[model samples]
Target: MLSRRLALAVATGAVAALALGTAAQAAPARHGGHGATLRTLAERPDLLIGTAVDASALAADAPYRAGVSSEFSSVTAENAMKWEVVEPARGSYDWSQADRLVEFAHRHHQEVRGHTLVWHNQLPAWLTSGVADGSIDAAGLRAVLRKHITDEVRHFKGEIYQWDVVNEVFDEDGTYRDSLWLRELGPSYISDAFRWAHEADPKAKLFLNDYNVEGVNAKSTAYYELAKKLRAQGVPVQGLGIQGHLDIQYGFPGDVGDNLARFDALGMQTAFTEIDVRMTLPADEAKLARQAQDYRRLLDACVAVRGCTSFTVWGFSDKYSWVPDTFSGQGAANITDENFVRKPAYTALADGLRAAARRAGRH
Candidate 1:
């Protein structure tokens, strides 16, 4: 749960009031700057750059062009594929919007990275309310979960390149978050989710995604243990997604490359997923500069790791970011301002990628 202070900020829309810039200043509604689609971004020899987008923001006739384009080869849905949006009710499914999003990506020649199949947040009211009775029989819960995973993965099939099979399973404290899955399926629910996803879409890569795992710490250690155990059992887990939701004021973890290497040694691909460096509101030159460097560090970490596959920002523009709403005093987590103007961090990221490419070629 978000802290009470942050929740209040989200509720009052004060965060939204602090818009990045007027839409009039934004660049013409078009695809990404690098003239690349999500798939192309992923194919880059360097780090894959990407951002999340809402389906309603782009035009249906040419959604790919008018939307925030990235050199990123892979695109992830912000929330469209989550349980709440996909299967809002028990047994009943609503794949209409999500299918359209995936179809749009295919039409535009992009690879869709399924945001998540299982998560503790944004659950449907029915599921949460049903579990409230505390009498959720194991068999019933398992059947429901299995069916949800089976149908969704089967539905997407070849459209999705990767699936975040289990998301935010661990809390900042390194223990499994108190979630329904833990309550019903024990800790093994995670492996089950991954196994089910693979069975449903054998070709799709499976990733374990979470925030606060960018460095060696209690949370990362927990992930390391889980990854090690899963790999030893040949659990078919394909990758690890380090969510880079950073804060410039709070010094970043210096051993990011080391941590990522540890995961790579486990034989799983690594990705910087949901990246955005937030700072206290009222951006200053120093804060912006630090934010740029923060981005460089994250990109550098990805470049340093051989198996790191992609790097994705949670959102491309401050105008569309979920940060301000999700966390108090975080109005500038995006690389672009409200008007779609590139921020200094954008340049820093491009520079980092170019440097990494040059370094890779030297070898």
Candidate 2:
């Protein structure tokens, strides 16, 4: 949501437990050589490999649709389920486009991770304006927010595997981001949001998602402390989402494994939720090679952590990447080019998954 992430723009587009043989048995990649699809390699490690999907592109582009359907076993709606798209007019809700996505997931035999139930960005105008003008008093704001979470969660209750109950709530400095909810409701908003979401879908794992928390730094420490507090209060806060939006220019976040280890110690689900490594300007073989290592590094961290159950790329192709638009002079963040060709980073992920499968097999 911040500079570290303009996470999922539009365009683009795991696991199991079983024998290594079982992974080998899963479908081979359409274009991948001797190696099976990333989804297949994930089976033995019992991890979910996924991507943020652009619903419009899925509907109109055949190659994009095929790529999503075959390459990943889980899907998150890039913007389909966001507040502005689903509840554009406050009380008026439209689930047409979002429902199509859920259906597509079902048809592809993919699990769905709800993009978010609470976020400061992409909010509908009516809600923000109401809050701005004091038309939505604190109590009224609370009620409205509760209703939004309840309705959305209840509608897709049993189908969704997880819900990003609160997203990008904290800034890089470890302070709660100033927003309508924070200003009116104070810090209690995070716990309240989780409670409301849990009440609506008890089966779904509720997660606190944010960027820049890929390591055990200030931002991640804030999440760790808050998650510990929430769970102690019986808040049903069940997961931590690390948005792995890395940049090759900054080098990889070396402590990602250590960060995920701490969360694993918390005994809650953790995931590399939205990962994409970007470089500055034109891509060279060296930059691309380093990008591959970055992708491999993040995926390796997740595979090594017991509680980390999923790894997802923000989007799969550069054709529809949000990077160029959001960050000037930085592009080539995805694993594929515009024509759906795989890159070194794509192979790196496949290799990581295979290694995980081998490890799982050894055990």
Candidate closest to the true structure, highest lDDT: 2
Worst 10 residues of 2 by lDDT: 1-10
- Model 1: per-residue Cα lDDT over 1-363, one tens digit each: 122332343355433223211221233433234542222223353344566757666543232334443234446788889999988878788987788777655543345778888889888888878778755578778878888888999998877766888999888888889888898789888888888889998888899999888989999889889989997887888888888989987888868999999988988888888999998899888888899899889888887888887788887778777888878877788876776566788778767766665776742
Q: Residue by residue across 266-329, what tens digits does model 2's lDDT show?
A: 8788987899999998999999999999999888888888788888899899888889999999
| Model 1: per-residue Cα lDDT at residue 235 | 88
**Total clashing pairs for each candidate:** 8, 4
TM-score of 2: 0.91
Lowest summed lDDT over 10 consecutive residues: which window, candidate 1?
A: 16-25
Give the poorly placed runs of model 1, Cα more than 4 Å off: 1-47, 59-67, 134-136
lDDT of 2: 0.82
